[model samples]
Target: MARAEVREVVFRIRWRWVRLSAGVGAALGGLLLLWGYPQVQAVLVRSSSLRAEDVEATLARAPLLPSSTRAHLGVRYLYDPAIFDPPRALEHLRRAVRESPFDYRNWMHLGQGYEAVGDRARAEAAYRQAIAWAPEYFLPRWLYANFLLKHGERERALEAFARAARAHPEAAANIAELLQNEERVAQLARLVPEADVRARLCAFLLSRGALSAAVSLWRDLDWNEKAKLGLARIMIARGISTEHYALARALWCALGRRLSERAACSDDLVWNGGFELAPLREMVPALSLSTLGVSEEFAVPDRDFDWQIENEAGVMTRIAREEPYQGERALRIEFTRHENVRFSGVAQFVLLRPAATYEVCFAYKAEVRGDPRVVVEIVGARRGVPEENAVLFRWSLPREAGRAGWTLVREVFRTTPETSLALLRIRRVPADALADFVKGRLWFDAFSIHPIEDGVRPAEGEAL
Candidate 1:
């Protein structure tokens, strides 16, 4: 072959070989990239679905991913556990937030996670962050407002509701339903200066059977004359049938006054006259109405009177004497034998009118060594007369040892025609004492009974 031909042929073969090699390399590179893509995706998906144990293992292996991520993983793992692990969930949620400060969803999830874990404050912060990042999102605002409501931040909840309403006007019906369910409208009516809002609240409260609150709010707002009258009417209707006749009569009297001012009063006054105070001569002629021997009793214990200790629990031996009534007998209660003890007795009194409302007042000072639950019971002449009436009223004190200095306790009893004989009894039950073990003692004194018609007397050192 000629020299030029030989050179051309050699160059052609070398060029073809180089091109083939390049093509093979490119094909292999594409295949490798395709193979690696799924592995990378698999890693992410595995991380997303990582079991609590796996995440925990990862956390142990890599402690530098930040506390927030660990907390998030921990929360996820505990989300559906047989037992709720709030502390662990809280720790992980907190850590997740700390690790990813700018992630909005992270904050939202963290807030929910914190709530699930029972960390209210942190949950609130997380929700606030979520709201800050996505101001238009209704879920965060709704959740945050609910949280505020749960914490008794009614005003803040209202503000949050307003914001949520603005963001999601389409959700107005739902929001209204929520507000109604929460009695939000009623709450707003309490503090809201807007007349329309107050009216709405009044209607809501009335519907919810919160007549007293509704009436008070109505009087404050002065929104509806008819609504106010209606409220009073309902109250009168309900109250007159029960022991609440006195309260119902009072409300009716108020209504009568309103009617008189409007020139609406008439013969109706006599029908509502059930609440009128009777002449002293007519009510209790034997008490000498011309020169009644009425005396005001002070809460302070008289020096001449002596107190006695009665400990049913045998474990309590020595009683401690404190200030004021120091020398008076102190009752030591031992809760070792039983979880609760009842101290009770009868007071001397004769009911002039068995059907009248009698008001009982007394002062008690309790130093509870354990859990103190003091219940005062007044047995009416009627037996099995409902638990509330049988017990009259009960005041529960915490389990602590301190001088609860002469706290006044009052109970109003409605005597029936059947109640010819009645007795007053006060029982103190210690929480820590067993049914057999009575471990606490309470001091009670200055018990007196007066007709509710006479009005409540002032406490010690005060003038009525």
Candidate 2:
């Protein structure tokens, strides 16, 4: 062979050997990857489960994981006080955010981590970033609002809180807890002016006894929204209980105008006196008048104007539609106790003028086996006076030998100088022995109160 041909043959042989070696190396690498991929994924899956042992294993196995895994681990270390490492948690969270910049939750975690370290500026930046990423989310906005509020950025914080509450109304309760003072509450009210949100905030204030804030919020609501869902009634009832008689009256009259019921805002002072309007007890299924037949469902009236029937154990009261004294319904009270029991189960709250004369009238018929006489009385409520001293007027029913059909009972009396509010109540007159506690039924209807013109005293009337 020629020399050139021999060199060419040698080069070809070397090149072929080199190519074969490279091919073998590539195949081995591929096989190793196929064998190891599932194990790596398995470790990651186990770590993601967040169990203590699995997390430890994954931590030892792989130093670099996905953003979500890092975020999870970050949360664990950030919140778990036993293993809490703020620095390490921040490191993990920062890595997670770097790995997946689009994940808003990762940003939120990062913000919280920064906040925990007292890096207010960085924390705010991170929170804003998270909110920018997920504008519709509630938590980020809520957290940002809290951060701002903590830093005394009241206006900005209120705006952020309003946004959060608009997104999720449940946030109102949390905001309420945060803004305990009246100023902050007013600021929040201004920011979130929607009636529903205001209503929720008002309810929270009422529950917390933030009287001024509650009253202010109630005034902000339009007449229609105030009447919605019986919120006005609740506010009035709270006012009466808290000795805010003026506020109660204002709410009652405003709501009456909204409802277009002249009688509600009229001078009668007794709402639903004829028992014509369905009381709250007759509204709900569980607390309805129908349930009174099966079980004695007891609850006070939610509205100040509605009758607040006393929840005495042996007394059951319900609204009866048949044979009402004047209207479609009357209160039917039955006493089942066999022993002497002090009973005052039917009542209504009314606002009255101090030192003014008023007449209370009602019609009733009773069939009694025992001499359980019922008495009507007007007693000053929230007066901090002795029971006897608070009694502005009292009338006892004349004993009935026969079942007298519907009969009228009326009385006139002047109030004490300080009596601005009173309760029109029917109480059982306890007789010696079991006479007053005998099982008997009574029907009451056409209860009414009118300011006595010229302050004239009416002749004492007989009761059935």
Candidate 3:
């Protein structure tokens, strides 16, 4: 062996090591390319690709592997902006569905994702799939109706509501409310005559607790006898008063001749049989007419017995005086200010029965002021009464010049078992302390009280 031979061998060994290192580096580069291609594709699909750092950060916060790790990962990806490329999100959701096809929640989320991306047709298809998976599920129907409403397909929306109502009668009220709130109904009504819109409107109104409006609309519509009878039935179910029933009766009589002519001889037979009237009597109970007496001189100015004040400017007119029956002097105070004031009063009335709910109504006018305030104070021995005057209602009206005529303000109060005499007071706050109470004139009108039906009242023969 020689020194030159040793040097050559050493050089060859080093060359071999370099060749091996290069080959390993190339293989590692290929592996990296394979790993990065999907992420690159994701970026192409949606400009924002889920970054590795984000995925790592999320995984760091989430509970590590579990039996349902894949599903949780899917949800995380679906919600994570870095991981949630639209296409990737959809893929995750699809995987979630495949893993749990019977899961209504998964399908619902899938549908919601599609809807969020504005793929309505696909979203609808997904909703239908969810319904098919769980026919008894109420949420899918509600979602489907929402889709129909968004697409401006109102008839379809109504049909969906009908299905939802039938499936969940308890939700009938909610469905009806949705229908009534839909703007399309009004739009549709404009396209057709009032008669065509009547049934739908009645159904909508009845569902939304607009019983009075529905009954009024029903009476004016050209419904057939059976339909009219059904309307009356619903009205009775809705607790329409005798006054409303009397109005309905009058309208029925007025339409009697025309109804008979439309129905021909068969219609005449039904009308003569009094089948319609039979249900009216059976479903609607008669209300007893009762008169309520007050100490002050008050007149029922409207059908609802609204009271009014005549001479507001005349301060000589005693707003407070004793009534003939109970000897309770009524005090009336006129407000002439731009700002709201706090006024207090105590009522002296002998309650024939305790525990009755009473409605209190007052009329006031707002004059030109920056911000006019109105407050009502009811002080009585009722339990749970506030230490300060109990504020039943508060209103702020825009201060404009002159008087805005009379506006009715009302509140319903429940009287306690121990309540005897109640007090009512109206107060107006001046718009500004520096500004005089000019043009703040509020006309104090007639004040009246009525007991609420079905409200708790003292037993008969009980004295206040």
Candidate 4:
């Protein structure tokens, strides 16, 4: 019995040793594999490139591999594309994405692989899978759209482009521009139509001065407030009447229709009468009001109806941002020096009726209202006799310093029986005021010229 027990103990010890040896052998083998994997992968560069036992170790080395198959796919996409193997690359990419279902790039690369292998069905399915995984991602949708387009799947490609537009509209617009297919772009726009998208497109077109194109898109963005306002500003800058733009006119009329006396002042015969329009010149010839059949002009040397600095050598004329009587801006006339005490001020060419007694009115304030030589008159184009001692300047009253109060000035005169144009003039008449020169700024606003019944002379410079 003792001998039997000894043999059993020996057997038990031998079995334990064997099991321990097996465990140690496995540990050593695992360590060797871990250490030699990179070397083996390097050695299997081409022959067993994708099938080597150590090839998968390459993926394991990159921790982000499972999360994004892009690096693995990039390995297959060499600087020399001729060496790429789409089918072999796709096998590993599919396995990685199956392990990480949330990976968008994995699905995307799988789709690209399927496309390279000419499997259109699988390619489209893979692209859709990528989109489904990351609905807000632009790259997948953009790639999908491009892939479908490359395969001549036009309808599905448009749908994919629409998806891209929905994801990142500006990027989609860039692609649309690249496509240069106007009709297709229009159709794509209709499919995913967002007002902001339309507005952005319109704004881009308009910024490039693509007016007709912008006009075509305007109807779609008509109700968008920002777009409408931007278009209105563009129209205003063009200096053409709002009538040229039906949308702009609609906006203008909409604002007016909300108020009483909507039509009373809707049609002002003056162009930039309130001194609000830009390039602040004398009356521009592109006057929207064509009642008198005046062929308007623009940005030229005609100060016909614009307030002018008669003595530009001695005075300066500018539109001021100071306190305006009615609008945000007013006309500023600064007299720098005395050209023999006859300094220049402001003037306008008034278009009036034949045999008409009209009221010419405007607001003015002087830093120092000087000599009656400064007069305002409606004189004919043909000067028969200079009307000396005219009450044009005899009528202005002065005010305290630093006060913004304006003195209203007006005068009435009869139009010549055959006169269609008259000079609405303001100047420092040749008078004897011993200030040496007319120095100081005078602001004017709310200029209006209209005929009254019974030829009553309108009072000038009535303080408001």
Candidate 5:
């Protein structure tokens, strides 16, 4: 053999070895990459907060992720200001919807993406598709309604808003805002057919200063309807806060008349004046005279014309049956302990003609101990009236009347010029010593208040 031939063979062998080593190294590197990629992907997946770039990189690497995941990532890219790319988001959301056409959220997001790109027609179509997929769901309806509203499609937007509000009554406030802005309160009855929804709409109107509309809607609702829907007390409160006194008066009188209690619309302005009605402790979902006897959680009070009684310490109030001055029922107040309590528990708000004279008359029988000096006080309750000048009239109950028969007490008083609202309360003037603390029971009945007309005869006592 020649030496040159041997050298050439060794060179060819070295070249083959070098190529083999390179192939082995390449295969090992590919195996390592395949093993570690999932760990890196999982880290990104488990991240507490992810940037738009991170989401984009993740979508690029993991194409086999769920369609919902891809749609969510599209939302991130579409909304994130740092990397807001509507076209890229539209692509991702479109692909997601293509993969899972039944996903309403993907359709909704696609609509938003189309909206971002100023594609109104496609955006509206996508939103309608979402609604078709989930007609009963509120989100799609609300979003679609808002989209219609943004495009100045007023009538279509109102229809959509009504559908959304009907599906979820809590969304009625949104419709109320729209209606208020458009001055479309007259269409509320047609828009919301449900009575409960009307109540909510009325309250919203009142809160938003649509006083005339709220009052009009309230007037159309009957007493039974308001009672069934629990709107009587709610509207009364809203009326007082909004200074809609006529509405408040009408609600109180209507409820009182339905129960056959002592409420009147003609001459008498005081409600339940004869103590024939029980003060409601709470406004239940469904309310009536029969339901008021049961004790429940004390919530908001009927602050209109009904007697607003408070649970005072050491004082118990109820209707007594022992004595009959006018009817079988009489308001009875009993003091259990010797405490110098400033008792103002029994009260009612009465509407009166400003600067007009009226007579307040009542029958009471007392068996009280000590000289607590309970008085019937009529005070001006105008919002900014000073406490010192609030008292319009004061009549003291006999301090020493022990087990006395029914005494008819009468007092004539004139309302202040600025006072159309007055507080008529039975108060026990707080004494300096516990020795003057009142004990025992007092019974009252046949309370009445009426305007004093010209040439009216001044009676010595009132007949209960």
Candidate 6:
């Protein structure tokens, strides 16, 4: 009898628990259905499946959706092919905008509504209002910029588009799209004035193997590795043309920016090896001089000057304004009078195949007081741990004790089997190390490096 009573109580408790769970599930489902109403209209509008009456039914069921969604619905009503009501949309969106003056999206939607009705003046006013309400936001400015472009306000539109790109980089991807299409290149290039934007566009062009279009765009632009790699990868595949080969060489020389990381073996693994490029001091990035009239007398800085000047306590380096044997510039280093800097000059770390022969070539002139010589050494060590330095080869050239002309120095050697990364460091003879007075200026120009394949002809270019 007790067991039967317990069974009856267990059945009653299970029934109550099931009822409670069903009620909670139904309530949650109702809330979820309500929450999805705003997005439903947007999805329907995009898919062209929503009618004016359908939107009205949604709004009637739920009035909690934002003014922006309501305004958006009105714009949707304007686009329905069979029996659309743009005038009604204009009114609905206008009322929404008035009620929510700070809502930037509603303002954009209202602009679209006005534009649908041929009220362009009012459309402009609404877009301008949207921009004014949220100046830093990208969407309002992007919409306004596009609207201005259609109305022949192109110059203003271009500047606005640049601002939008700056405000958000993702917008640049869209601008890049317009530039990628060959037909749109001339049109957009003539207007958009941001190097960041153009570089991305150029990168896209080169990646897609649109060499003709890429080259044309490049002539108007500047040195870009991401873009250059696109060229280099093509060369790797299609066999490099002479013009393509030179560009590939230049960019390969530039990626020498990293030292500690083991380098992937390539032909020339020297950053700015020729010293043809340098960063412009203090200028915001702008459009490619393709039309901007920027002089091509300097290394176009992708970020930092490809060749980094080592900063010790008493050393300074600059791009030599004179005596360049290659494109335009060379490196200039100044050692302070009477100050002892143990390591002062330029250094670049490069990857070399272990047991493979390589050559370092450079032309340099020194004007010094202490008969301080210049030492170019290849040391087997990674960056930041010079204590592990292993001297591979050292070329010491006596900086003219008297008046001497530039001397060409070349050191060729085979890296050890364990030496995958090495530093090409240039510095003064050790008067600073020996605690003696030292002061001088060293000018290095026309630096280049090449791997020796069979050890016969000069694989590296002439450091003329």
lDDT by residue (tens digit), candidate 1, 162-226: 67756764443345456765356545444446543444444444444555665666676552433
Residue 251 accuracy (lDDT) in model 3: 41
Q: State in Å the error of residue 448, model 1.
A: 67
Q: Which ten residues in a row are the worst by lDDT in model 3?
A: 299-308
Greater-TM-score candidate between 2 and 5: 5
TM-score of each: 0.32, 0.70, 0.33, 0.49, 0.79, 0.40
Residue 386 in candidate 3, Cα distance off native in Å: 30
Answer with 2 or 3, whichever has the higher lDDT.
2
Alpha-carbon deviation at 426 in model 4, angstroms: 13
Sorted by TM-score (best first), the order is 5, 2, 4, 6, 3, 1
Give the candidate order by descending lDDT. Answer: 2, 5, 6, 4, 1, 3
Against the correct fold, how does model 6 do in TM-score?
Answer: 0.40
Q: What's each prediction's clash count?
A: 18, 0, 24, 12, 0, 2
User: What is candidate 1's local distance difference test score?
Assistant: 0.52
Error of 6 at 422 (Å): 27
Candidate 4 ranges beyond 4 A from true positions: 1-71, 78-82, 152-155, 170-172, 207-209, 222-228, 231-438, 446-464
Off by over 4 Å in 3: 1-88, 181-213, 216-464
**In the order shown, what is each candidate's alpha-carbon RMSD?**
23.9, 8.3, 22.6, 12.7, 10.5, 20.2
Candidate 5 structure quality by residue, lDDT tens digits, 111-196 = 99999999999999999999999998999988898898898887788788878877887666656766556266446555767765
List, residue by residue over 91-182, the lDDT tens digit for candidate 2.
Answer: 88998899899999999999999988889899999999999999999999999998998898988988998999888875676786787776
lDDT of 3 by residue, 1-464 (tens): 66654443343368888999999999999999998677545433332334534443443453232213334444555577655655555665676677778877677767877876789988888888888887776788888888888889878776665555445544543554565553543433333343433455555555445556666667666655344544444444343222243333334444443434432222111122211111223323332111111111221111110011233332222334322112233333444422334433322211213576666554444344344454555555232123245333233443552454545555566666655434343444444556534333343433445565664543321111
Whole-model Cα lDDT per candidate?
0.52, 0.74, 0.47, 0.57, 0.72, 0.61
Instruction: Tell me how far candidate 4 lies from the true structure as C-alpha RMSD in angstroms.
Output: 12.7
Deviation from native of the Cα of residue 41 in model 3, angstroms:
36
| Cα lDDT for residue 332, candidate 1 | 33
- Residue 21 displacement in candidate 2 (angstroms): 18
Tell me, by TM-score, which candidate is best.
Answer: 5
